[model samples]
Target: MELLYNNSTNYFPIYYVKGKVINANIQTYGGSEKMTYGIGLGYYNEKGIFRGTGYNRVDLNSTMNVTPVNRLNVDLRLNASLSNRDRTSGDGTLQSASPVETVPGDPQELSSLLPGEGSVAWNAVLDALKGTKEKNRGVRLRTNFRLGYEPIDGLNISTSLAADYSIDRRNYFQPSYMSDDDYSKSVGETGINLMVLNENLVSYNRTFKEEHMVNFVAGFSYQYDQTEYNGGSAQNAPSDKIYYAPAGMPDLGIQESNGTKETIALKHYQSDMQEKTLLSYFARLEYGFRDKYLVSFSLRRDGSSTFGEDNRWGTFPSVAAGWTFSEESFVKDNLSWLSFGKIRASWGRSGMHFSQNYLALGIMNVGATPYRGQATIEPEWVRGLYNHDLSWEETDQYDFGLDLDLFNHRLGITLDYYYRYTDKLLTTIWLPGIHNGYSSQWRNAGAISNEGIEVMIKYDIFNREDLYWKISVNGARNWNRFEKSYDGKDFGGNIIGKPLNGIYALKTDGFINEQDEMKVFYNQQGVSNYLSNFYKGAFYKPGDYKFVDVNGDGTIGSGDAVYCGSALPIVSGGIVNEFRWKNFDLNMLMAYSLGRHIVNNLSKAVLTNGKYALMTDLNAISFWEKPGDHPDYPKLESDRMNSMWSYVDRDVEKVNYLKLKTLTVGYSFPKKWSRKAGIDELRVFVSGENLFTWTNYSGLDPETVDITSGFDLMSNYPLARKYTLGLTLKF
Candidate 1:
């Protein structure tokens, strides 16, 4: 397609060190420039569903590191990914026209009103319309090891190992451009948090002398993961243009000669998605005194090949205690300026191994049918019964802490407060079946409690050197509840443990004016959260926005979209400074967040109104040609575009932000001009990243979407870059 989207050089990117061992000059070569466009519409009005996918993978990870012994380590990574996907998902056309599994870029023609009945109204058309203009190449190889020993003296030991290998490929453009039907890949993994680890544990510190001072540990961890998707599929058809495939599919008598199925292996139907192996046996015990009250206990045991029966075994435990109010001696003689303070508490139980393999049980599906005509029995996509209690996914924690270091440390603090309860919760839920066809499975539900508060503050204002000032401020606040219910259903709304890879959309309250239009309220499922009746097809109203109808039931729907704020940044933190004169160095970073939110669908599709194509050459003319001289956006040409939630009013604010992410200026040319350029070190750097943002956030780039998933990705990718020019030589 325009010569592989403008080819620049022979595709290359392969690096693997463990599994199949392959590395070719650790590659890299430039090529990436994008420009995309989108417009969408799909029907459904009687019972529905919609789908989506938008792509952008701008990758460049270059790695190189090697350290031998004293705990060996090695790493080699290469990634040159450019996946500019533009997806305008589809769905919403059903109702008496089943068999709608139309794939290949779905939307198989069906709009003469109601194409129903085995739907030839193009029955979910999409006569195979899948698009993926890819250029993927990934490589990785890693190795790490650790070892330590102390034969006697109280005995000690240590061990660790980590290995990883990866290879990824993509160049499957089918229809044309050029292809030998290519794709080759491989993967391998080996992890071992090995630890025969031991510490000052001298026989329980000689029988807990004077209360305590003991240590003991045990270890063994093994992990093995494998992956092999091996790609290749083709047998003609791009208007029969080439790229092999004369025979393969339904074999055209081995089509003119070019045909290879070489034993078809898409991991042989995803052989249980391969990769399996896990072994664990961990232990720990620590007692204390003289170091001022402390107690620790730990236990862990696990074994898995993806679980089955007795859940493949699992047991985790923990207990902790520490108290050293400045080592208590009358508070260490009146808090000698509080040199150090500690207060800790713990209670734990953890387990969770992302089980996947008969997810606790159930499998069987085979196909090949002809019936009475000789071949038969058909069914697919299996796996639904293998529960030996299907195992792990437990978290029970309760910890309270406070560790402080005042004066002498120039101010340091850590205050933690926790209350975790995860109970069962490995959900697959729903079970109330009818002939065992599907109700819900994958048990262990209810119980979700996450209470939190963490604060980390450290300030040095000056740490020596020519000049250095560091200020770290951590913040956390979590609140969640589900307490109990798998189906016991007293009420199940959904607000379980909020932050974890944030982004939980639909909250925007500014639009609607006319002296507030009497609070707008629209129910009967159009929701506006109570006030009543009114809602005559509102286009926008009110001093523009503010909503909170949590459950007075007046209606604002999605149960009023709770969990109000956070697309990440409920107070994020960072501030650093270093200034030196000798070799001239200046680095600065200031990051902040006081609340988070973002939707600005390009400012709601150019301030709502429509008629702008936006192909982005930025200014190739027409801002709406004579549009009240730009009345704060809302001036489109009218070709029918406007609809970015047209004048939002979802109620969820506080995107409060403050940033200066990074700024740097450096100089280091003298050292006799770096030992006469024989290079050991050379520096030249001018940097600026995300330079500035005050945030009232109208948005063109507020870190492009993903405020935590509700799928509102209006085509993203390309907001990362505020600048960098470089040079660094070290050989």
Candidate 2:
């Protein structure tokens, strides 16, 4: 006997002001002979975007199995969760006292004679939900247990234990009449995190009767983690209905304004704790014959506590092989319509411990000075500078593969080639703040190398029973460099053989027309020494910008930077298509990226000459006025200070795009109307995510990176184009 069941539910909504979402899931299971059970439930709720963004979650899980004899077996699992989240911390209060162009540059314009104070773009999401409010509450627990033994037949042995716990609490309130400003505040936080895991296992399998086959496994693992944090904050609160006690506000007296007397700052709080551990040992081996030969081997040995105990352990290894030339009989006697093929190779080693300071190998921190003058806070070993060879961070990988199934199986292909090779490489080094006042030091020098190539293809192109079509394509290219660096120069601008997130600038050669304005004021070495040399003389002229001294050293700072591109993506891809008739179905996905480079920085903050150029909203692209008319920007300067080679090579660009990313249409409900509504299955779908894009990168998104200067694009957040309608039911 056998039985199984599953259920799902979802409701999604979007249209601003706390868009909504609700999801549900359920599972059920069945078994035969000596007990087996399962249960799962999940629910999620979301109402986000403005007004204290949202989240609500709940989950419960259970599993059980028992055999009790005849080679023993027992397993148990449980998980529980509860959550409530909402965090929005103010910022965004709509300000504009000038430069306003609230739409209208064409299409039967309506004039306002432009002056200012007319902006409205959802007033920055309703002034960021008026005056802050944050909340977070969470509780979670997890459990697992397992035991197994095979006193005979093929061998098996196991042992496991797992535990997890979580607790979070946060509360914040801002009200100073919601900062129309007079100052009022409150904050509170509580966090607790813990985890534990243990495992032991042994396994063996054999089959020497069908042309040799063997399997083996071994394992041992242990992990532990802990975190605790407590917080408190209070500021000038006399009422907003109290409650933010760090000894009840109001203290450190002295106040009188408008005639001077000031001094009033009292209440504050903080707390923290951390812990970490890890230990591991593992092994694996497998072999096979006549099944067209295959081999595997693996090994692992960890031991961490965030390194430094003289390089706290690490040892990883891997090996693999496969060959199945369609079970070769010379490819089934001369490739008669070949239907299968395989080739494989692999090599590996890995380690990287994320780094979360378990003292980072040395201690003493606390900092903040003043003492003899009363502003206390001490304990400092002068900030980080100990290295017991910090360790952990070793990559090393290689892979080669091929898989194919032609015609007889309706065409399919896959090919891959890879190489990794990481090496010490765990950021932050530089310590030498004039004798180690600590400015870096997180050791593990450098070395990086990544290589890639991948391809996948699938086809059906209409194989019908009632019409069916399918298509798929995949692509990859990748290539990274920087294969050594203990200094070899430049890290934060990423130099040394480039591509560690590349993109260094300075190298423009345009603008500056007016027939080169006397060869740029005679290479600007003078012009009568130009207004005392501001940016190497009289701050440019004749339509501005013209760089590229590139160590030819006619001037152009930072030793004329270089490597101006690549923020990943040296090829990337996707393409999928599917169509079906009968009950209707259609799908399309399409994504692409090539070479990669962006950084329009919102058009150098509104069309060149920097910092919100004429104050705001500009960029109709084409400057430089007259002098044989050419124009491609450069010449519109208002309070110009720009000149990092004038907006990093005129704002990068070329982020080769091609997105469609998703489009789906589906319908299914006809199984005689789902058996008169007793519904065994039902479906309805309409989806569009991103939907369209083809880029020349003027930046608003060529997939805008820059979440804090990862590759510098600036004017972040702007990539939302979605529409979804879905319904699916099964019982």
Candidate 3:
């Protein structure tokens, strides 16, 4: 029997930034006839207001291994975790103010105004934060058990079962003592998820003639998961003292216009649940010859309960091959600096599942229906038609790659090119109103193609006994377009031959000037008639935006709207550098993305329309005020009601940015110093994340785009900049 133990503790204490972490691990190993076991525990705590957020967590894990026979083994593992988090208010209202309200002025002047003692704006925000509170807590538990047997020398078999359970709870409360503009309410939500997975596998590995080797594995898996959520809320509480649901406020009842009075509902509740199951079978084979050539193939068949009976299963297969060029005698003899080189190619097929819970089998929903001019509430099928043959989206991909290592492997580079085509894309088929007024059916009748190239490079600059430095750079470029639609049609703003997230708008030819307002003419139509007929009678004086008539139809209309920009980035990359010298190390990462367009909704919402003119600082803008003022913006007006369509093209702007992702510096004490204190090693580090960003786009941040919707409305919480100083000791 043998025993082993390991432990570590980290502590950081700084003003407005403090954290602590402790971990313990233990293992017991026995001979083949005895059982082995291992256990671990971890605890972490953090508290900081300026740090944007804080959390505390505890984790525990245990594992046991048994070997009852010469060819059989069994292992069991369990893990549990608990965590709680606190976040700062990051909303527009006072109760959720983010970074406080900003006023237009110099930094020095703004600093002179203190909360409560100076400006009213500062005092209001401080009051709101003090009366609002939000909290989130979560718990997770997981367990796995596996049994393995090796009856023969070259063959092995294994079976495993695993289960996971998690629960998350959140509470948000705002007191009546908060500002008058804010609502007084309390809300709580709880979500629970459970999942079970079972798998069985068999593998065989053999080498023949000491030059050729082969390995194969086949597996079958089944997974099932269920999720449920419940929430409760109460609004218009009697006072700050009663913040939870079932708040008492009948004394302050609400009176209706019909001379009736009633108290608000003490508690309102909502709940939802969903379940999914999947079964899959997969196999893989790998072969290598002379340690220089390699080939691999894999296949998987999956069946999901979410799909219709006719299309419930999908097959995926992949094949890859590689050749080591550096292993050739001619190259090895001629170029000693080339340490290693390989070329590889691969082709694969995959499937995707989207947000269609019960689209394949239409659902009967409960809603209010009108019968005999009287509204009656009952259960009925939805208005839209259902498709019983909905299928999974399939994608086929091909890739070619090259890898190189030169100067004794000090420099390494990898390049890859890939093309992917997706067929049977899941989408809705819109139907004319004549059939069922604004109804649509789900179907798999869309196609898209995506291609990209990626390159990665790494080099060791300095390598010595006391100093070492290395740098890594990676970049990628991608292009995607819609290939086909069910009926060769466009939905919403999506168009064929264009990206899925492409924006459509009318082209703008700059603002109209005072001298050209009366002089300009459209096919014998004056400016006044053009504005009156096409612009919904909105007056456009000298400084309004001028649009190009794409159709030359004498008027501006929907037909003039064309593809203006896309939300997909053409290029993105990151650079990382690491340096070590005499027990000290430093690391930095910089990331960049370009060729993506955004609507700049934040600028259009807050910087213009003359709504918050004095309340917030606006972007640098120019307006046409006189005959010769030809500026980018229109004349400043308190109540300008221009057509939203007219500015759709102008609101779009390319977002290109470079950001310093992270910077860290650390130092480790010598072993001798730590050994004297009964410790194996000690390390201290300081790190900063999201230090700065350089961008031409005039929004909150370029990295805030949504992945599924491709929209950045600046409504969510802003990214936070964080700084941490920590020390670790291991024993």
Candidate 4:
């Protein structure tokens, strides 16, 4: 039997006060000769840093084993859970009015401002916490059963069946005070999903002459999944109190406006259903000689309903081999200190079928529209252009690795190098302007390649009875590129020969300092000609940014923009250390990343002099103010269009950081003391996460920024420091 409890709290700066978490679990197990059983129950709750946003869940799990016959065995497992999540934190209505837009003022004064109408940041926070509400509640259930029988030595057969089902309901409401139209609204949604799987396997294991061994296994599996969704929204609710129920709203009759009358339905509804299935057959064989040489091979064929009939099935195969040279007589006798050494290699091919259901066939939507002043049902245009030639996306990968252990296993090291290539990438292509009433078509378009090397090392410094210490370090470096495309077109920051998701921007040479300097530069660099050709001959001010002319044509154009950086990290790694003395133990973890860049969009927004508050930092003061004033940013002016400043090198920053990810210390009570209290063992621990960070990036928490777009637009939540205390008990 065992029991556990944990509690933690998160603290942030001015925007958030504190968030709390609570967790508890209980488990017990007992077994006899013929049967064994185990069961567990767990509960979790959290209060988010943002008001009116939190999550709660409860789950139960159980497993049982039975052996009714001499060579037959049966196993059963079941799991069930209920969870609820609050989504008010993601409300776009409040997000659009970000606190950063509020004018600078005292905290107490801001809080006293009028709700919904005030320009104070505190008002938006209050409205988000009280005026709007959204929540999703879900229930999930899963069960599995397996049976195995061994009729003869070195032979076994097994079959298993599993099923999962879940249901979810969401409710959202916004009062009239929170909307621009001064009308209360509500929305209701419900969804259900079900899946089932069945599998059967056969295997035989035997050793030949005690030095050579062979094993073989084969299996067949089938899976099916179905999902159904229905949702509706209603406006003009009677009152804010009538939430989560669309029926509370009433339809409004036709009314004359500008000599026109139109009927309006208070509620609008929509529904969707999707289903998919997969079937597969797989087999694998393994062989070994004297435990020093090993080889294995596997193959599988899978068929999916998401693909077209011509490409419904795909075949994948893999092979691996390993050799332990340390087991040879030469190493055993000559290199006695080398306890272990192995070299391994493998290669594999895989397929992906992730498109939406029924994408290979045309689809039509039905809706209601006004016809001759009367409501009529009509068929809308096709959802998307369909093509029956679509096939599965495939990836081929190869790996080679070496493992070594020295000093009686006190030091260990592992190194690996791998290359992966993917073709027939599943993506959407935009058609030429509303072709056949459709804007886009799904297609397999391009090829990409990735090559990387990873290394890991671990060492034991002290292995004494009372004191033990170990340290491990691991790191990886990868390079990714777009190898080929159908039309030789560049999109989404991917270039033909450059790294994927590269950042392209114009180079700048600080701000224009003086009018005389600008005049002399324009004459020599042809800035006047370039502006006239590209920017309608917009005149540049002394405080404006001066772009570089890379082509020496004396004008800056779109072609002058060059590749600056990439969104993907070139190197990333982590380090872990563990130590124990007597009954006390300690662990520390650190993580780092390099060669990634981010565009500080938040800085651009604040410096644009729009309807946003200014940042109270030294960077904000570095804007050019007058002639002869050299500055890092352009002059704070909103009257003219500054297109050159939109994408410039000034906004891109290299984000290299080393963070102390976690640290923990714990002590275990002596067994005698625990036994006196009717307990088998007990332990207590304290841990801290995100405690320290070292970085040159200007953004708040570089690790939390968006990796895909590499833009820090202030939409992501900042990482919070956390402290946790926990206890474990067993009997």
Candidate 5:
């Protein structure tokens, strides 16, 4: 057995709060129960988890909303955090000493005017630490911050700013590194240990709404981020403790010594200063005639930093008209079942920025520029390659909705349907040309449409004998399409049939049936089963799982791939049922999604837990015990690889199932009992999540989906089930 790290430790205080001033002193320590990486910075790379952030600091927040002035609102917020963390570097690299060096950026950009002087060394940092442990000393700080704002309604003006001055040495790890990824352990020490950050954001919000309901807003801001990377490891202690400096002391003068060092990805530290401003003019007008009909029109023009020279500004406008049918003279009192009804419709156009700083303007990457002497890479897109010019991808949507309330508002229902078509899509794909380095330039080469229908219904079930019951259900169905594309224009291919955005791999069929059945089977590549088996001259065998070939070509191939039909239940929604009796209450919320399938991509990994790091704890190996065990899962070395179907052929299934999302049971003590307890009201609740699952999926919970992995159909992160018991009191 190989050991990634074996250790024992104690660390120091990098953070302590003395009144409002928090001081920094770093000392961190720990050993790996399982292999883990040594991060030199506060990395946010989340691997198998939501974010790559290492054990993150627990945050504490409190807010105070105070009315200092009659018409003004003042709000103050304070935040604190306590986190336990440790980081390690490789062994004794500091022995072969290197003198400190300097860089040119400030902690808060406050040093921007001065030629920045920074230091990095094999020994300089080692002297500042105590402990033979391979400690990164980035021990987290207990930080505190305050934000205050005062706002006056009609005047529409407020200033909001945030400061996160951590006593923790400032270093930003790229997002991908701090992820909860399973692979994080193996590559933990791959990046430089660095620190540098004192950032701030301050902004003002101002809006003007007129008597006619015309409203508008405008703003500007700047952001500066700075970092300094110190990749040195320590001495003495252990070989894995790179920052510990082999001698365990900084001033020991162990220079010119030789030792091992685990190389981490030296973070390419670079500072970015972006001065951003948003200029906009907007107006909205609302009019109602005799309170029976209403009309609204609004327009906004915005200029931003992300656009190219010509497309720096985009203008959006919307118009809506509604009719309140119940307000009519003849309809006001005729119907009791229909208390009120409003029919409304609207059309609007919105623009989305591509976000690249120079997306709109042509740019040249100049290398080592002395103006004329600089090497520059020119923009490749020949100007005017397309008939149209640049503009933000535009989405034009039209909506129709009906809002109704019946029987004194006891039964209420709302139905809305919308269709949005987005054109000038700003995305890039490989054009069919090797001349342009295997690709062509970026362009608005296609269009897509998103249309959906939504319905919400609520009813107050009858109440009797001091008990009340209510039920409500809401759901929506949507269809998305790639409306047009240049490639489809010249070919017979169904551009409209572009496969659904993310389809579970092809559904799987059980073991091959009769010999004749095996003959028709095909791999995703469209290779014929008959031809394949004939050449091998094999017949269908029992308990040998099989996959059906959608294409008669008899192979599971890209050619046989088709758009997924009704995936991940196009119709997804939840139902809430509530009942109240005396002083007790019960509520059940059940939600479901059908038509979506999970490829069980991790099947191979899990099946072979015999080899991988995470799967080491699995017990399902050697699945079939004896002759008639007739296990459906195969235990083959080849099956674990690209065999069953490359990452694409899929052994997918229709992930259609219903589940209860949340159920809560609570009890409220009688008012007299609350008074005895000196509380106005008291309640307690018990809740269990993912209490049950009814599905054929063998992997894990069906509710959670992994965002990162897909190419090979591996199982995503397994969602955890939780149970909570809580209490509340009101005075």
Candidate 6:
């Protein structure tokens, strides 16, 4: 039996709240010469920091092992869980609102506002207080049975069957006070997913002369998965108290008022179902000689239902070899300091099919359309494009690695280099001109390559009965590029010879502060009508941003834009330190990333002297107020040119940051006290997550910034700092 409890508290920059978690689990086992069995039960409950949000779950698991006869065994396992979650409407909506709309102003002024006539902050508060309520309930079950037998010495056979099933239901209700149209709304949704797997395996292991060993294994597996979803929404309920069920809403029909007929669709419905299957056969072999040299090879053939029938099967193969140099007499005698050393290399090929079903088949959609001034259900003329040539995306990868241990095994190091090349990339491509009445079609096009190196080191500084300390550090760097594409055409930011998702923008010079500076800039090459043409006929004066003319004949056009940076990080790593003294332990982890850039869209919106509220940090001292006054930002302006200036090179900023990811301190009670209390063990711990960050970024949280588009739009919820105190007991 075990019990755990945790208390959590949120930190600054966001609303302060307290939450808690409780977990309890019990396990028991009994064994005999012929059979053994174990059973476990667990319960968990968590209260979120936000109001009206919580989760509760219960789990049950059982396992049994039986040896009916010599060299024959049977195993059975079953696991089930039921969970319920209370979701708040503010999760995605209210949190994404701008800080200016949620943060309050002067308390005295806010207190004077009238009912229903308050500021944006007051309105946001009201909506959160009377918003929609949502609940999600789910149930899951999984079972597995296996049988193993040894027909002869060094030979074994096994077979297993497993099945998993889960279902989820959601209930949502929004009262009239939370909607802009003064109408109540309700929605209900349910989804079911099922998966089944069967596998068989045979293995043979033998050693010859005690100097050579060989092992071989082969297996076959089949899996099937099915998913079904159905949901609907209704509006204009008779009362605000009705929740989840929409039966009280009006029916769908035609209504006439003042000689005008209108369709009344109080409810909307939707449903979908999909099924997929996979079949695989695999084999592996391993050989070793004198415990110094080792080699392994594996091959697998897989067939997936998500691809075209003709190209559904794919074969993948891999091989690896390792040499233990320390095992040799030369290394052991000469390099005594080297405790152990090994080098290994491997190459492998894999395939991916990551698309929905029926991509290779043309299909028509059925919907209601107006025919002769009356609604009719008919098949749409537009249909999906079919490409029987669709195939799986495949990748070939190579890896080389080195491992070393020194100083009596107190220090260890690992180094690895890897390269991957992928072709026949499954992607959506735009049609030339609406082929088959579709704007885009799925196709296998283009190729990409990624190469990187990683290094990790660990050292045990102290090892003693009373005190111990250990530290580990790891780092990695990667390079990604688009190698080829269909017809050498650039699509979706994938340009040949360039990093994927590269940032391209026009460069900018310093702001124009003095008349002489402006004149000198305009007098450069291609100088005629520079201000009037580039500024889009706006009132260009001192303190306006000046764009650089990259090309000799440049007029601030798209051609002047150049590749600036990439959204992917060039270097990332983490460091961890652990210490133990007596019955106390402490751990700290730090993570970092470098060479990543992000567009500060949030700052551009609020810092350009626009109608939007400005941050407290920006003031008159930050912007240019008069001629000959040098400042960090341009002059206050709301013109079109000023808006475009937000996209200039200045807006793109490096988001390199070093953050303290986690810190934990724990203490365990002595065995004497635990024995007296009739408990096996007891421990207490305190942990902090997202405790601190050191960065030059101007965004709220650098780690939360989206890397795909490299834009910090302020729509993401800021990462919260949490401190937890927990206690655990066992009996």
lDDT leader = 4
How far does residue 594 in candidate 5 sit from its true spot (Å)?
2.0
Q: Which residue pairs does candidate 2 place in steric collision?
A: none
What is the overall TM-score of model 6 with all chains considered together? 0.87
Q: Comparing 4 and 5 by TM-score, which wins?
A: 4
Better of 2 and 3 by TM-score: 3
C-alpha-based local distance difference test score of model 6: 0.76
In angstroms, give how far residue 627 of model 5 lies from its true place: 19
CA error at residue 558 for candidate 1, angstroms: 28
**lDDT digits (tens) for residues 1-731 of candidate 2:** 11121111111111124356667777778877988898889888867543346778999998999897788999999989998876533222211111211211111121122222223423332343444566667899999898989987888998888889888776776666654346666777678888889999898998887898999999889988888887766666777665355565765545577777777664456788888888999999999898898999999999898877888889998999999889889888988787999899989898988448554566665546666776654434444556777888899899999998987888899999999989888777666556645666677778889899999999998888778998999999888878777867757556667667766677777755654353333445544321112365345556766666666644556677676766777788899999988888999998888767756554454443234232223435567776555666667657445462255765666567889978999998887788687877888888877779987765445666752233543433234465667777776
Clashes of 2: 0
Q: Write the per-residue lDDT of candidate 5 for residues 428-522, one digit (tens) a residue.
A: 54566556442444566678888899999999886676788889999988877668875656122335645335553443454443445555555
Compared with the true structure, all predictions reach lDDT values of 0.50, 0.69, 0.72, 0.76, 0.49, 0.76
Q: What's the lDDT for candidate 4?
A: 0.76
Global CA lDDT of candidate 5, please? 0.49
**Per-model TM values vs. the true structure:** 0.26, 0.28, 0.84, 0.89, 0.61, 0.87
The best candidate in terms of TM-score? 4
List the candidates ranked by TM-score, beginning with the highest: 4, 6, 3, 5, 2, 1
Candidate 3 total steric clashes: 0
Model 4, runs deviating above 4 Å: 1-15, 88-128, 246-248, 253-263, 367-383, 432-437, 514-534, 549-558, 609-620, 626-628
RMSD of every prediction: 32.1, 31.5, 9.2, 7.1, 14.8, 7.1
Which regions in candidate 3 have their CA more than 4 angstroms from the true location?
1-38, 44-54, 87-125, 177-184, 235-238, 246-266, 369-384, 434-438, 515-528, 531-536, 607-616, 638-641, 644-651, 705-712
Could you give me the TM-score of model 1 versus the true structure? 0.26
lDDT of 6 by residue, 1-731 (tens): 11121111111113224667777788888999999999999999877665455788999999999999999999999999999887633221211212112222212112212222344645665564447677778899999999999999889999999999999877777787766555566777778989999999999999999989899999999999999988777777777777755445676645566888778776777788888888999999999998899999999999888887688899999999999999999999999999999999999999987547777665456556677886555422343566677888999999999999999999999999999999999887777774445766677888999999999999999989889999999999888899998778877767788887678787777767665554323455655443433554563467776666677543566667778788778889999999999999999999999989888765456554321232323343366677666665677666665334457787788789999999999999998999898989999999998899999987677787777678765544345577778887877
Better of 1 and 4 by TM-score: 4
